[model samples]
Target: MKAAILLIGTELLNGAMIDTNSIYIAEQLNKYGIEIEYKIMVRDVIEEMEKAFAFAKKNVDLIITTGGLGPTDDDITKAAIAKFLKKKLVVDEKEKKELVKKYKDRKIEKKSNFKEIEKPEGAISFKNDVGMAPAVYINGIVAFPGFPNELKNMFPKFLKFYAKENNLKSKIYIKDIITCGIGESILEKRVKDIFTEDNIFYEFLVKDYGTLIRLQTKIENKKKVEKIVEKLYNKIADFIIGEDEERVETNIFKYLMAQKKPLTISTAESCTGGMIASKLVDVSGISASFKEGIVCYSNEAKIKRLKVKKETLLAHGAVSEEVAKEMVEGLKTDVAIATTGIAGPGGGTIEKPVGLVYIAVRVGESVEIIRKEFKGERNKIRQRTTLFALYSLLKMLSKRYDI
Candidate 1:
């Protein structure tokens, strides 16, 4: 089935609010193999809303709208749809009673506030448990409240109702191979030959964590999908971090936690701030393996907190591999990761330009230091350093444990 989304709000057009509802709606519809052909954003003008309705009705099988459902005068979604369908607007008495009971203790003027319960004549109404507005389904269009929380709560019920009415079933099957320390172009070039099958499809998304290689097929047989996944795995086994929904930090956390003797880890960060530590901490129950993280941004802090030699900083500078090695080694954990880089629009010399990073991973008696040059703005450079450090540590541990 094909559908279109109409996001309505003057706030959205004027940059006062962001329309996250469309993204959520699209993801949910994609699971049912519903193709989204258009995403239209309109201001809170009735004329514009009517035009959008006409376009959606003429082009798509289904239409979904979010926003302009409120008690205020500008809330004209129901009015516009009713006018477009040549139907009369009437207040739902059952919904009005519920609203009156809900706000009984508060002093609210029913003459104006009860407009929240209005719907087009002969349209099916849906309750909003999270907010004051009532949603409606009339003539192939489903109207929802603009608030994200309310829309999220009401969407599932609408989906269930629509699925029963249309006899829709989940159609999209998906698998994701999350990998790190690899560029999208290089990974795609290596695996381009594996996508020859007509029944299977592939997509590559490069996120801050890494590049995610998505393998999908409409074919429902699990065994057939597994065969394709296994073949692709063998081709890029060394670069793969984990399977679907597994990030590099999560992979590292799980690997460390499953060890017979859990290895404790710590972090000493400079240019990346505490992003590496933050990612590890996001994984629940990681404290068993993650000890602590120290942000030694200043030269004095490095010398005092992580016990780096003052002479080393004076000779080789703080952004050198020597300091990164000392930073990791001084942590006194079974494993440690350290990063020092120049992520900036300024403060770079001919010797060390911006995006120059040194990462160190120390495990037991051995320490590995790497020098890397990345390109981007400040935050992007820092993000690259953080992901590279985590992936490097994971690769090292995987080899050590033969995972």
Candidate 2:
């Protein structure tokens, strides 16, 4: 059965609060074979909430909403749902008893938020173990509190109840083939004919390091999906980096950490401003292999820290292949990566233009530098360079022969 997720919060629409409830609920529902076809976010406004309910009811078999259940004046989710369903808002006596006992047990003062703990009439309600608000599953919509902690605590009980009622055991069939050192257009042209069948849903996405082929099939047969993945792998064995290619930075760090022999890596940054190093640090236990990261933004830093000579800088400028290579040469590690570029909106000249990036990869004794005139603004260029540097490092560690 299909489902729809509705997140009701004015703060979410105004960007003051991030709505993670939808993501969490969607993932949980997928475990029960409930596919979510629509994800919507509506403000705390009653009109918008009613409209969201109407749309979701028309679109899917199940509707789930988070937020608007808190003890505040803006907490109007039950009221909205009641209006939408033409029902009356009634106090839940059981939930009220629990709340009253909790207040007495804890010796806490009764507040305005406590009065808001009511459910819509004619609905199945689940007790909230961690909070005052009750989880109500009514008319295909499950409503939870706005707070993340309370929602997480209450969602599991709702999941079990819903699964028992629906009798669902879903199997997800998905694979992402990540290819490095290949352009998206070329990769698409090479493998376009492989997915001509009507049953497969495939997408070609361009990532910084390479292209990603996300293939999803509707059929849940494991053997059938495995055969398809195996066929596709055989066709693109030269480029496919497995599903971990989707999570490039983490995968790179994880692979490096799992090596039989420990390896050290160093970074020399220019236009990327230590973005590659920062990304590597984001992964847990990166210190196991990550040795050092240097942000040599200035020419003097390159000369002093990375031992880049002043002569090379004057001859080829900071954003050049020579400088990138020299920067790597100065670093001693199992793998050394370097970046030099002009990530800017105004640094273009007749000879050198903005978005000109030079990335260097040094694997053991071998070193290679790639130069590309990338497109986009400052932030985009830096981000692309950072991802490319990580991609290059992944190649050096995993596909040593390719480098």
lDDT, candidates in the order shown: 0.88, 0.80
lDDT of 2 by residue, 1-403 (tens): 9988888888888989887778668756755678899888899899988888888898899988888887778889988988998888888666777888878788888553554567778888777777778789887888988887788888888888887787755555556677766678888787787775666677887755457787766546545656666777788766665473246677676666665776678888989988888888877788888899999999999999989999999999998889999999999988888999989898888688898889999988888898877788789889878877777667666766321
- Residues 38-60, candidate 1, lDDT per residue (tens digit)? 99999889899999999889999
| TM-score of candidate 1 on Cα atoms, chains taken together | 0.75
What TM-score would every model get versus the actual structure? 0.75, 0.71
Q: After superposition, how far is residue 266 of candidate 2 from its true place, in Å?
A: 2.8
Error of 2 at 390 (Å): 1.7
Candidate number achieving the greatest TM-score relative to the actual structure: 1
Q: How accurate is candidate 2 locally (lDDT)?
A: 0.80
Error of 1 at 91 (Å): 14
